[model samples]
Target: MSTIERKTVVLTGASGGIGMATAKALTERGFEVIAVVRDPSRVRDVGAVFQADLANLADVVRVGRELAEKVPRIDVLINNAGLHAFSQRTTVDGLPVMVAVNHVAPFLLTHALLPKLRASRGRIVHVASDAHRRVTTLSLPDDLVRTAQFSARESSFLYAQSKLLGVLFTKALARRLNGTGVVANSCCPGLNVTGLGRESRTFAALAKVLAAVGAFSPASGARIVVRLAADPESGSTSGTHFSRDGSVKVDTTLVANVALQEQLWAETARLPAVSSLGDFR
Candidate 1:
């Protein structure tokens, strides 16, 4: 008789939407789901939950270290937590709330757990969005941590820029993980009716209406993430941006701009909140 090995996945933002759905799907497929959330009680029954307030970068580091010390091996890491702020906000780390939650925190967590991921030769999937191109222009370094001063009217564009950073981060990470057997990729969840907009009642209502019409369900949006995390075919694939239909797509200029990616990656590492991550090598 042969014994089967159980795959373990560490996921962020499993309290709702694509993250929650992906957790369930992975669980059904016999993978152990470890969720990093703000409230463990909310997801206690779903899988293992580690409490962390992603808005606070220090907390992210604490939680990441905890996971690194505890989990023996991690087969996959899904950076699924995200936030689209209606107004400019800052986290305890003094970085823009959107940038902190959507990008920086994930960067920190992934680095903290790199050793475990390397041991398992794991995969990393970032829940990005086609909205990256919507930013029009990216003024790297500055915009990566500083949210442009804006009103609610311009909030969507800010959110787009954050997701764009995720794409760039994945591209840079893939290069770094080259010989380590760890692959990195980003995916667009389409327009799912997730609670990402609960801060605005009007937007929330609109999302509900659109969801009822044709927006992908949370479960539907999670499929690509699950595939990227668990499918053997995706193991060899890295540094690619995947769309809702599993097609590779990101602005040509963005992917070709290796200088931009490198600059961004270097600056991200030096961020006050993440500077201490050291080389997880």
Candidate 2:
């Protein structure tokens, strides 16, 4: 009898609603779940949980190196951690918090663990959003790192722009990993009563109302992520955005621009958080 080998998935934000749901579903399916959480004390019943603040690049680099050193092999990486805000704020690293967590941190971590992913012929699933379509214009690489004064409404647009970057990053990463058997894709899990908007009381109240009135459950919202991460058919579905119906579509016109994607990749490589690590590009 041939023994079956359990597949391992590294998931960020595994302590939250959608993430906790993904962890449960994967474990039940016999996948070893390695959770990258903001607080280990809040995480339970995963294979292993490593705590790190995604808003901080130094911590991201530290944890990425640790995973690369210790995890041996990774069959999938789910960049599910994210944040939304009604106000603009910068991190200690001098980058916008939304941009740092939603895009750059995942980019750095994925690159740092590229070797393990390649060894396993793994998949990369970014938890992006359809919100990207809401963005009207972006200044490219410049808008990625710089944040200026903006109203609450403008902040929402800024958040949308950050998610747009995630979509673009997925496409760019897929291009970079071509012929390497390490595929990358992204999905927009429909809004659920998650902690993504805890920064604002109004949004939190609105989310509760939406959840009560038939918003998708965290488990249901997690379906797209689970599919993109573990579905055999999804292994080859790179450089696309998946909706709730499993339909493939471009997240936005900006994400579809190859030139913009390449520019984003090059500029992302130049980010202080990534470039300071030396030659990961």
Q: Output the number of the TM-score-best candidate.
A: 2
Q: Which stretches of candidate 2 lie over 4 Å from their true place?
A: 1-4, 211-214
Q: Write the per-residue lDDT of candidate 2 for residues 23-142, one digit (tens) a residue.
A: 999988889999998899989989998889999888998899999999977999999998986777888888888999999899888987889999999999999888898876778678
Best by lDDT: 2
List TM-scores for all candidates, in order.
0.94, 0.95
Candidate 1 per-residue lDDT, tens place, 136-207, comes to: 577767896675578877888899889888888899999999999999999998888899988888889998
Off by over 4 Å in 1: 1-4, 210-215, 276-281
Candidate 2 is scored at a TM of: 0.95
Q: Give each model's clash number.
A: 0, 0
Model 2, clash count? 0
For candidate 1, the TM-score is 0.94
